[model samples]
Each structure stands twice: as C-alpha cells, then as structure tokens.
Target: MNIYAIIETGGKQLRVESGRFYDIRHFASLKSQNLSSNTKILIYRVLLICNEATISLGQPWLKNAIIKGRILHSHLENKITVYKMNSKKKTRCKFGHRQNSTRFVVDSISLNGKEL
Candidate 1:
C-alpha cells in the first residue's frame, strides 16, 4: 500500500516522498568553496512507525506512530528584495538576501512513516 505521512522540521511541516529532493532548514552558515556546502540538511529521527489501518483516529495514538526522513543538501535560496520608503520623506534603502536551507527526502514510510 502507498504510504504518505506528515513530518515536522525547522518549524515547518513537510510532505515528503522517496527519492524526491525537498528544501529544509540550515541554522549554520555555509562558506565552503564546494557548491554542495551551502545547502542545508534535513534528517528525521525514527520516532514512530505505523500504517493507516493502525492509526487511531479518535484515540490518543496508535501503538506505534513513526516519522522518518533524511537531509540531502544545504543550499542557498533566491535573493529577496527588501525596500523601505516614505511617501514624501527623502529616505530610501534597498537590499537583497538569500536564505539557507537543507534538502531531504522521505526514504520510506512504514507503519509510523519510518524506513522499513
């Protein structure tokens, strides 16, 4: 049976799948010359594993609800523009920035959405 589950990371929830690259959070700055060094990593812990049939819809939880994923790359994102302006005041400033993040994929989701 096909399995799909929701997992949380970096103050966000991600819908993941196997062999599919996704963006994640990277707290550290990347300064390496290699292109791969700038990417953020996203990895999941095997907390719980379960199947849809085993999920407790009304109850607290099933016997074992698993969540799992893995970090792939830590990379930079597109630069965003920041602008400040006043209607009549002679004050203006502009800046651009790129956020950092790691990539990950849902390897496999079993009963608890963890690897088999």
Candidate 2:
C-alpha cells in the first residue's frame, strides 16, 4: 500500500511521500543544529497520514507521529525580477530577488511508533 502524509514546516503545510525529494523554506531551527549533507531531521508537526485502506487526522498535530527526512542541501531559488516605471517623469526602477530554500528527501513516515 502506498503511504503519504501531510506535515507542517516553515509556515507551510506540505504533502509528502517516502523516498521523494522536496524543496521547502529554510528552517531557522535547523541553522543552530549545524546541519550537513545527509543529516537526519525529525518533523513532529504531522497533520495527516493516509494509506490505501485508512486515514488518520489530527486536530493540530498527531501524537507520536513523525516524518523522517534527510537534508540534501540549502540554496537560493531562481531570481525574480521586479520593475517599476513612471511615464512622462522618465523614472524607472528595477530589482531582483531570490528566496532561500532547503532541499531534503523523505525517508519514512511513522505513526504511534509503527512505520506505515
């Protein structure tokens, strides 16, 4: 049976599956942990878990539910360009920005100490 879960991290809720890589917002808590490549991360804010036969939902977070992942890297996203122009006054402004993000691969999803 295929298993998947929804987890909250970095102010976003993401639907993830095992053995998949996802790019998410950079986590400030991870910065203090000295995360390197292949570092394991435990996410406790799991909202839902689904299998082919059944589903479990949490009011806010599931007790004893965890999502395991490995950090791959942290990098910036593609540049976004912003431009402002004013007619007659001959004024223009242009800027670009890139958002910082982290890439990780989901290892497993477990509920109540049992792997799904």
Candidate 3:
C-alpha cells in the first residue's frame, strides 16, 4: 500500500509521497539554521492522509499528523523577466527575478506518532 499526504508550506499546498524528491519554496527555518544535506525535517501542517484503504482528513490541519523529510539542497529557480513599456512615451523597463527553492526527499508520514 502507498501512503501520501497533503502538506502546506510557504503559503502553498503540495501532495507529497514517501521516497520521492520534491522542490518547494525555500524554508525560513533552513535559512536560520546552518544545515547540510540529509538533515531531517518535520512538517506538521498536514491536511489529509491516505493509506490505500483508509483516508484521514483534517479540519484545516490534522493535530497529530506529521511528514518527515530530508533536505537535499537549496537553489534558485529559473529567472522570470518582467517588462513594462509605455506607448508613445518611449519609456521601457525590464527586470528579472529568480525564486529561492529547496529540494528534499520524503522519508515517511506519521499520524498519532505511528508511521504509515
């Protein structure tokens, strides 16, 4: 049976599964702490969990649900360019931005302190 959960981070919701790599917005906690690869992370904002036969849903978030993962790396995403032009005024502006992101591997999902 496969187990997966929906987790919220960096103002976004993501569907995460065990033994997989996912890239999400950079975590502020990681920035505060000097962490390297394989550092364990516990995510507590889980919205739902499914284990093939049974499903558990939370009212906003499950109280005892947690998702465990390990940080692999932190990097910046591709650059996005924004351009503004004024018609007949001969004025133009352009800027590029790259978003910070982190890559991690999901290790397990636990509910009520028990791994699923």
TM-score of each model, paired residue for residue: 0.61, 0.91, 0.91
Residue 112 in candidate 1, Cα distance off native in Å:
6.0
The digit string of per-residue lDDT tens for model 1 on 1-116 reads 44455555556655555556677664232333332633333334322233445532313233344544455566778889999988799899999989876665655555534454
Which ranges in model 2 have alpha carbons more than 4 Å from their true place?
Answer: none
lDDT of 1: 0.51
| Candidate 3 per-residue lDDT over residues 1-116, each given as its tens digit | 46889998878899999999899886655663544677899899899999888899999999999999999987889999999999999999999999977889999999999999
Off by over 4 Å in 1: 27-64, 112-116
Cα lDDT of model 2 by residue, 19-48, tens digit: 999998776468835567888899999999
* Per-candidate local distance difference test: 0.51, 0.88, 0.88
lDDT of 2 at 14: 93
